[model samples]
Target: MRKLLLPSLIIVAASLLVIRIFYLQVIDDSFKLKSDNNAIKIKYDYPERGYIYDRNGKLLVANQASYDIMVIPRELKNTDTLEFCQLLNITKEDFIKKIEKAKIYSPRLPSVFLPQLNKSEFAAFQEKIRKFEGFYFQKRSLRDYEVDSGANIFGFITQVNEKLVAKNPYYNSGDLIGRQGVEESYEDILRGIKGVKYIQKDKYNREIGSFKEGRYDTIAVQGEDINLTIDAELQKYGEELMINKRGGIVAIEPKTGEILALVTAPSYDPSILVGRQRSKNYTKLYHDSIAKPLYDRGLLAEYPPGSPFKILTGLVALQEGVVNEQTTFMCNHGFAYAPGRFQRCHCGGGPRDLHVGIYKSCNAYFSNVYLRTIGKYKSSPYAVDVWSNHIKSFGLGQFMGYDLPTGKKGKAPTSKTYKKMYPDWGWSGKTIISNAIGQGEVLMTPIQLANMMAAVANEGYYYTPHIIKKIEGKKIDTKFTTKHVTTIDKKYFKPMISGLFDVYNLGTAAGLRVEGIDICGKTGTAENFAKIDGKRVQLKDHSIFVAFAPKDNPKIAIAILVENGGFGATIAGPIASLMIEKYLRKKITRTDLETRILNTSLQAQYAKLGGLSEDIKLELRKNDSILKSKTVIPKIKIDSTKEN
Candidate 1:
């Protein structure tokens, strides 16, 4: 019995050993095959980005062919570092750092040595690439701005970081994405579909052939093209007008809701961000503290709307029955707020009606009207809340839902806001007296101001303001084309518009009015908080103007601002009038106007003691030089085709 038991035990142990060996060699083959596939095989693919164009079918942003030097650190062996660095025109340290970063990203995936390579760089690298392993050139497209019209509007594309990649499946490491403006708002539509290819590679990592003879390949579909509402000619003219100024301008067709011109001063050339030199140029722009050329002041700048807010107040007053078309208010050069502190009126007369109030931009008239309107709400609990809601209905103190991205919702203090600060006090009509004349925590962008003018011109109705008119050969739905109707009676706007017309024909803007055209306009001198010294002092006021042409049947509406430009009537009003004249009449009698704008220098202004900074002075000089030098003919040109 003992002998039989020993023999049985040995047989059982032998069977178990055979089973364990089979599991190790055969059952685990799938995991080993996957590991091998990941180490030796490589595939790289880039999807083509979308295109951008202007209203007239002109290309605004398009994809151009460029190369990136991709590296796989694990596969790299005994590479010619000196030759590679020399070919890329980069230092050895940079090359080593970039390679180390690539290794950190992953060994199987490709990483960038240089992005947005020009034709010359690509050519040089292509020649010496045969001697390198685990490194190759990947072809893709980078955005190219065509006419340099809208820097902020077009935005910029840059490499995707690890955080962005982890959140989104559509993007991988080393992908370019839109950072701001229209590019960001329409990223899904503008970014073309990405395609992939599966290819069989040998042990040496050489592409043998397609995995399934191109059967499992995705066909690359180009991105949808976007057509803007901007007119290149008008945009160029507006940008020219805003050259020396530190402000913004937004002009649009009231009927079509098309943006004719949108200008933000102190902007950089779009061409600088195109090729391999992008990083260097971007770094310089990023560090520039004074001019801040990269800042999109047009959409981002939030300043007091000043007298422009009176237009809305007028509409509200007329709608709420607080004031009629013939109502009048007495002005004494300054409004008595409490005692010595007065909100000054630009008007200098004793008494003025609604029409004269608009022409004179009477602060007291609007303030009285606002007080009366808020007084009706005194009996209600939701007085402040309801009043805030009424203001927001006009698209103030909130986002307007425009096509452009990252727009500011200018501050409009609510009842709750005031309540939080002074919950125990009586918050009555006089509590928010300053907001009536467009001051005291009220702020808005020039685009919003222009849209308000458009709404006024349309008699309390306007289409939503937009930069892109059409996209992908399909016109954007006219749903945004719907008109925004203000609560004011349509008849009330006629008299207000008449006063605005008188402003151009006989009042403040008379000096800048176009001949043979009925232009309606209003001006504002917005006082800023910035001071010249330790003592609180009034610096030059920001010149501001809002206007529309052919008052009976308005075609264009615009808003212009000139930072630290003194008075609105003299500086900004004329600029807007000139722009309107050029658009409506097709020419200007004052050819000197262009010359004056181009040649004007801020050196004398800055030279004043404690007036401006040295960097600002230098930047002004540089800007003036660039503008003056940008004439038809160059002073010197080296012609490679012709002999010296």
Candidate 2:
């Protein structure tokens, strides 16, 4: 019986093994796929990157022919290393490093040896292409900017590193990936589908023919061209107006919520980051700590919205039913909350109504209103949470989820925010009363401020501000089409609109009004601060302005913020008015204003951040050394000398 059991077990095991082998050989093709991979050499057909056009169909970004030297690590023979290095303008050390990197990526796969070669370089290298057995040219398209502006908007593309390749199976050793801005946001769409050609290789690794008669081969699909919502003329005009200044301007269409112009000052031409010079230019831009040209202040800089924030305050006050349109607050030059703790204001001391408050940017009226809103609830935390919710409903404290790949969630203080800060002290709305005037812990980006103005323009509703107007054979994201309604009721926005209109008629921006354009705008001068010598020193104010035009059927809503610019009306207001006029009328009526802004340069004011001047800074260093020498005690003291 034991002998019979042993034979039976052996037979059953053999039968199971045979069944498994049959399944692997016939039913499953995974092993066959792996075998084919070893015998097949893949040739990637990289498609052209998508064309980018402005809303008016003007070409903004096009592609130019670029060549990359690709290498298969195991395919190299007794090649002339010196000739290869000299031809490619690379060192022997660089060749070794690149070769090792490619091997680490995949010995059997192709990797970039030298990328982004011009036509001349490619022609020079093509002559000796047959000399190098492992090396070959992989033609690809490089971004050729049609316009010189909007580098921050278009962003740049670069070769995928080992880290990116390991994470995404779609990319290999030498693929391009978008870095920042719109390019990154729509990378999958813009990159298109890469096709592959598989050639059969013999035991000697010589190409024979197509694997399975090109059954697995696919044709390359060119990237889909896209239209941005940005108006090319408006974008250029806005960039021109912001020359030599550090600021951001965001203009949105009030009717559709399309981004008309996104301008960040101290920006570089997008072409600088295109070819071989891209890496060098990018490094230079990255190292520029001051007047950071690479930094997109339009979406990243979180400045105190200044008086532009008062718009949200008023809206929240109305929504909370803390104040009515006719609500009046007394302003004795400012709101004096606790004894001698006064928030100073420049709005002429008088009994000011809501209409009077907004145009004049009265600190007193809004502070009182803010305090009243907080007073409505029993607990300060409860009150603040309510206020924060109303503020966030306008998308102040969070990311607006714009199509751009980069941004900052400018802070709107909540109860939890204050609870952590004022843990021991009793607090109320007046405790953080600076918020009422767009001060305090309140901060907002240029885009957010523009969106807020758009809400006001649409009378309590705004579409999500987006950059895409149309994508080829595809619909823009539904979020861009969807309307975002504010917490404030529609009826409450009328009086606020009247106040904003009065701003152009009888307010701070009276000197910068456009003819035939009934503008509704607010000027803001948020106090700037810097740390000098371990002390928080107050710098010049950040000039801010937000506006919408036509007053009845609003077309454009815009926001501008200039760092170290003194008063809002002086720099930001004039720029905003000119932008509105440019977008709406397509011609500048105010030539003098345009000339003045073009001529004006704030480089001197920006330099003052380090010291009064180079001479003054030198003098201070000199004095600092002198003071240190005077305070120093003698190393060899008299007492020690006497004892010796």
Candidate 3:
């Protein structure tokens, strides 16, 4: 009996010991995980944005060191609110509101107090930051505009909004985002991978050491570099040349499709938009009505292409067999369409052939050619459709699909668009006559116009226009390398080339061609509407010029538009010549011509915005005292010519 009792007690003790071991091994894991969570903090370290460089390896956009005053609201205590407001140059009420916003973002996490403070402001803040327990200074990178220009293309970087974070899991709330232009287009490539550090904190909530002595810490990866196609020197020169003028200049290398210079006049210094003053500076620039500096005229502004459309018309007629190089029409100052309604011509009476018509830019010749070109088709509708299709193939009446963001596809009417407006029972060639002269419904961006020149220069094909040359040592999409074929044959471009060459030699543009340089150019003067005193007033003309130099083997294709500039040959033509010479020859000899065009006229400044009716202006100016307290406005000199 005694032996049996001792064996039973030993078995029970062993069973109890086994149960205790299982409790420690299995059930205690949750407690250990909680302890670890309390000891460590997870932090994301941001990577630097990629640098921007021009074709010559010159830096254009880069990063500058910026400091942000950050605060963890939950940890803040005994903070001197008045003193902090004074240091940040804000009122106490303003300071309090900012804190509320920061708290809504995250109470435990650090929120930015003062963003992008300069050296002087940061140095002062650093001295007082130690006294505030919950607040600290964090180092960040802000966009630095080196050239003080190219605001529209280079664009600006700002904090990622909640909407962006929700759409992309890769972005954090505080991360910087590209707002426009190349910056926005290449956001994924330019933004580098972020890193994380697993840190251990002491009881005081201060970092004691990295978790596992930095074993799990990830190193930050740098962003991919961006190589631009622009030439910094040429771009700056072009911008200065177009000062006080509302227009744009786009210059592209004909062979490679590299944009050498993209200039939009009345542009503000990009550097002014960085840091805490971004909102204030943006307001000042945004309210300027005369220049509309934010408007990107080079790629965004669409205008009736004017006489430059003659180049396309000439090509279409020759290709369609409606006209030949020797086809002649008599132009006796104008063509009498109806008894009193005549299409006038600046070129007087002459028996002008197709080549001569292109040289003199005779409207009568194209009006006849357009009718013949379309009438040559089996049916009138078929001719109009086919002719419009050919225009579309040249990248006109459609988005050029440039690498830049937000482009306008200047209106090219599909038969559907016209069908809605015309209620057409019977369509004829005369109905679309305005399109033959590059006016009426035909409109296009400067970039698209330049690309059209590229197609002509290539004889029948062209690459898509692009701003980014390479990213992170690799070139942009392979599609940009694909040659877009036009409907015209390569041989057909030969005779058309002669007509364009004659344009610079014996045409309207003949007077402006540089000696010893074979320049092919087309000039245009377009009419636009402006509002003044509750009435639609005929504003100054828009002068436009499109050209390619060394026409036989073209090197550059350029388009220049000067708003309110009179006569494309005088104002816009010289600017186009200067830009072409600056890019190809690397020098400008026409200083007087540049000065005369830059300081020509300012009539358009007084013209009211089209959106505002005349009655509103009267009400706004009712008080003589209010009208007299005018700010010193900048003088604008405009050239009244059709620049497309």
Candidate 4:
């Protein structure tokens, strides 16, 4: 019986072993996957990025073919390093360093060895690529800009860093990622999914065939093309007008809240950020701190809104019931806050109402109105909070949630902020009366100012300002489609709009009116100061203007800021008027104004504050010559022989 039991146990164990062996050889795929990893070479097929077009379907950005040399460190075999380096136009040291970097990234995974090779370089390397083991060339696309404007808005793409690769599994080593602007904002939509293929290799690492007859492989899906609200011609015109200047201009379609043109002065050609020379050009542009061409001043620069802000003061005064359209006060050139301290005004001393206050830009009238508004509330702190709330309702003191990747939340001082500024003494409206004139603690970005004007044009509400009008396959977020209503009542905007209209007809911006367009605009001159060597020194005033054209049913709203350009009416007003005229009329009737602006260069103003470095000066001088030559309007002859 014992002998029979032992034989039975042996029989059971033998049966179990047979089943396990069958499973290991045929059913289990874990070991098979591991084996495949060793012999299968994976390659990626990168799809071309989507094209970017303007509102009118004019191509703004397109793609051009580029090639990258890729490497898998573990598969590398001993070869002639010097000959390989010479063939690829790289030094031996660079070869060694790149190899080391690839190994550090992953021994088995692929990494870029050399990137962005032109057609000639790719052709030269292709002939000898078969001799190099574990090295291959991958085809890709880089941005080919059709227009030379909007470098700040049409950001460039660059290779992803190790940090980014580690953070996002979707990206691997040597992958290109968008850096800024529309590219960064819509990276996922613009960057199509990368397709992959696994090639079966023999023991000697020779390519045998596609793994599983390419069943696991996928075809690259092309990215979706996008259309922006930008007007390419308008953008180019604005850029041309802004040459040799340092500031920003933002134009918006009032009804739709679509950004028409966003211009930052001192911008470089977007093409400079493409190809093998991208790094070199980027380094030069980055190091030129004096002229930050890469900086998007329209969205990022926080400056006091200056007198354009006076429009808000008038609106807030009316909303709080502290002042009316008929309310009037006297200004003796400025508002005398304290016995010795007076906030100066340029509007000649006279009796001024809300309408007169806005056009004349009377500091005294607004100051009195602001004081009354604050005093209406029981406590100054509570009043400040109320005032802050009213101002912020216009999208001040917070991010406006524009489609751009970057922005500044211009300040609208609340009680909390004032508390931080003055902890000991309790504050009052008089203490912060400078805000009445848009100078003290108020600040706004160019886009914010433009959006505020858009709200006024819309009569009380504004759609969120956005650069993207339509996505190829998807609807824009509801936030952009929904209207953002201000805290002020809709009824209050009437007087405000009237006063702003008066600004063009009878006020500060009266002289710069377009012939037919009834443009409503406010001129501002912000006091510019900087702390140099631990001392506050006043620089030239920054010229500012905010406007909307055709007064009623406005088509365009714009804001222009010219740093260190004295008097808003002198520089910014004309620029805004011209921009409006160009957008509406499609041709400049006032060529004299156009000539004045095109011929005017603020390089001297920039030079005064050490704003121009030697390198920037040289570039500006070269650009100046090119601009001068192009702007020389040629005469049109009457062809009498072929006349109608």
Candidate 5:
């Protein structure tokens, strides 16, 4: 009986083992998947990123071949550390640190050890690469900027960080991603799908052949080409004009809302943020706290909109039936909203109607109109919100929904915002009358200001501003195509536009007109304040201008802001007029104005102000010297090949 029991147990155990083996092989392939992962090597085939062109079909950005040194930590074997470090032009400590980082990322997956190798470096390394184990070269493309300007618009591409890799499975260590502007906004379209090759490996950790006869392999797809709405000539010209100044300029097509030129002063050449030296150059630019070349003031710097906002005040008043074209308000060089508080103005003094209020920029007229609008509602909160809603409908105090990745919703104080500020006693229209003249809490970016003008030019509607004009085999976003109607009725636009036209004809912007172009515009001077020694100190005012050319049939809407530039007509207004003439006539009849802009240097204004640290100030001077050395060409004629 004991012998029979032993035989029965052995038979039962064998039967169970056989069934489990059958399940592992046929019914469940989990073990096979695990085995396949261990025995197969995956290689990536990176495709070229798309080309970028301007609206005139001129090439803006292209790609050049580059290489990277990839390493898998677990596959590494001892060779000559000193020799490898020397060949790569890196210290032994750097090599060790990189290896440690790669191990921390993954022991099996590949990581970038050294990247952006030029042609000569790649050639020299390829010859002796066989001596090193676990290391190989990965081919890729780097951005080749065709033009020298537009760094703020084109943005840059860089390697993914540890956080990004862990968050997104599609990305691995050393994967490239766009960082800002159009590159970031259209990454999916610009960065095409990468191909994968699964190669079978032996137990000895050597590639044998294709895994499963190359069934898991894929071919890379090239990224789609795109056309930008920017005009290369206009963009270059704008950058040239903003050379030594610190500010921003945004130009949009009034009919289509396509961005033409976006200029941020103190910006580096787009080429500097490309290729092997990108990191070093970027670090230098990023560290300049005083002259922030990397900061996009056009989209990010939220400053008071100034007198240009009165255009909206008038339009809103007209819409709400609080004021009409002929309504008059007496101004004594300012408006006394409260007993102790007076909003000062420079429009002289008279019985100013809506026309004179706009063209002459009368403070009392707009302030009274704002008060009347607020008085229409019983609840101050509701009243403020209604006025805020009317303001918001113009796309102010909100994101412009442009194709650029970065922006700020400039503060347009809502009822809730005011409630938090004056929580105890609520608030009154007199307490916030500064909003009538674009002061107190009203702020806007240059792009937003330009978009607002575009809306005014189109008579109460605007297409959301966008940079992409066309993408290969793909449609643009519906938002850019759809029109956003303002709360103000279309009828109010004609009257307001008349006031704006008079601004160019016989008012504040009278001297800033282009010869043949009927430019309807507004001039503004926003008071500048800075935190110095833990106290707010007033600096020179920032010059601002907003305009749309050929008032009857507008084509271009532009906004410019020059930091610490005194009055609106002094700097920003001339630049706007010049930009309009250049775009429309394709030639600058005002060479005098062009020369003034080109020769003027606000470098001292920027370096001295802003409460910059001593080190940052020194760095700005050093950087300026280097920039001058590069840009200042000798009077002697040079070879055309070396002109760029």
Candidate 6:
């Protein structure tokens, strides 16, 4: 009986082992993958990234072939490390460090050792790469920019970190991911699927043939092409005008909410962020604290909307039924709210109504209207809450949910915020009267201001501003197409629109009007202040302008801000006028205006600050030198604006 039991147990164990082997070989792919890893070499075929096109079908971004030296830590065998390092123009210590990092990621998987080798370096390395056991050249495409402008719009790509690799299963070590702007926002659509190939290796680790007669291979799928709303000529022109200045400009189509041009001054060429020199150039840009070239002022800079905000105050007052088009207020140089306190106005004191207030930018009139709007409610907090809600309805004091990856939600002081500010004392419209003039706690980004103008141009509503007009063979998100109505009634906008029209014809922006176009605009001078050595010091006011052209059916709505530029009419208004003329007329007959703007330099004002680093000073000096160079303004023809 004991002999029979032993034999049966042996047979049972043998049958179990056979079943396990069959299950692993036929059903469970995990074990098969492990076995394949030992005997086969896997290679990735990276797909070409999508092409980026401007609204007129002009190519903005394309791709160029580049090579990366990839390494598999576990596959490494005895080889001449010195020769490999010499061929790749890297130190032995760098090679070891990269290999250690690759092992930490996954000893069996591959990682990039050295990336973005130029054509010459790639040609030299291709002949000698076979001498290395674990290393091979992987082909990838790098961004090829067609135009020098729009660096803030089309962001660059860099390798994914360990955290990203762990979070996203789709990514492996040394994978490139978009860093910012549209590239990051549309990464999934722009970065197509990577294909894989498995090649069987013999006992000597030499590739014999396909692992399973090419059954495991996949074909790479190219990324989808995307069409941006940006106009190439308009974008280039805006960037050129913004040279030697520091600030932002954003333009949107009033009807469709499609962004036309987004410019941030002191921007570097897009090509500088590509290839082997990317890290070095990026470090330089990052450390220039004053210039902040990497910072996208259009989307991220929060500033006082200045007089451009008074337009909203007028709209809100009309909506609240506190004031009408015929309502008038008298300004004795300013509005006297308290016994001795007064909010000053730049407009010459006179009897001013809503139209005159907006056109002339009367602080006293707007303040009076704001007090009436707030006084309509019984409780001060409740009144401020109502006013806050009315302002929020226009998409202020909130993130506008733009397609770009980064933005700033500029502040709009609510009742709760005021309560925090004035904890003991109760507050009222008089306490927060600065808000009536777009000062005090009211802050907005350049894009938000542009969108607000778009809403006003549309008369009552606005489509959320967006950069992507269309993706190839796919529909855009419904959120961008949906209409967002403001708190103001449609009828109330006409008076306000008329007021804006008069601004170009007879008000603060009158001197900056364009020829043969009905340009409606508001000029603003926001007082700039900074804390230096623990003392609040006032600097030159920021020049601000918001406008829409051809008043009846507006095509473009724009917002411009120039730091340290005193009086909105001086700098921002003329720039906005030129931009409008360029977009509508397609040719600037006002070359003198364009030349003057191009030649103007604000570097001296930027240098006045005492806390800047030496690196920043050097960079500023470099830019100053470039700006001082005499460069002729070309005769930009109307044909440049033609559709491709």
In candidate 1, how many Å is residue 231 off? 0.9
Q: lDDT of each model, Cα atoms only?
A: 0.72, 0.82, 0.76, 0.83, 0.84, 0.84
State which candidate has the highest TM-score: 6
Can you write out model 4's per-residue Cα lDDT over 276-335, one digit (the tens) per residue? 889988887775555667778899888888788878888888888887788889888876
Which candidate, 1 or 3, would have the higher TM-score against the true structure? 3
Report model 2's TM-score to 2 decimal places: 0.90
The residue pairs that clash in candidate 2, if any, are none
Q: Across residues 22-75, which tens digit of lDDT does each residue of candidate 3 receive?
A: 887675443442243656776777778899999889999888888877777888
Candidate 6 lDDT tens digits, 76-186 = 988798998887788989888988988887777788888888789999988987788888888988899999889899999888888998899878776788889889999
Q: What is the TM-score of each candidate against the true structure?
A: 0.86, 0.90, 0.88, 0.90, 0.90, 0.91
* Model 6: residues with Cα > 4 Å off, grouped in runs: 1-24, 27-31, 34-36, 75-78, 609-644
lDDT of 2 by residue, 41-119 (tens): 8888989889999999999999999999999888888889999999988899999999999898778788898899999
For model 4 the TM-score comes to 0.90
**Judged by lDDT against the true structure, how good is candidate 4?**
0.83
Off by more than 4 A, model 4: 1-36, 533-535, 610-644
- Name model 1 segments beyond 4 Å from true: 1-36, 39-48, 337-341, 378-387, 473-479, 531-537, 590-593, 601-644
TM-score of model 3 relative to the true fold?
Answer: 0.88
Q: Write the per-residue lDDT of candidate 1 for residues 1-644, one digit (tens) a residue.
A: 99899899999999999998898777644344235365234354666787887777887787788887778787788888898788778899998899889888887677876787888878877887878987878888888777766776787888888999999977877778887767887888787777766667777667788765665567666778888888776777777776655678889899867788888875656777778777877776676554556666677778888887877777777777778887878888766756565666667768877788877788888888877777776634355555566566666787877788767888777766777767787666666777776776578888888888888888877777888787776668676778777666688888888888887766666677666788889888776543443534444467789999878788899998776665777567877877887777667765665566556544243234245556556654544432311111101111110000
Cand. 6 Cα-lDDT: 0.84
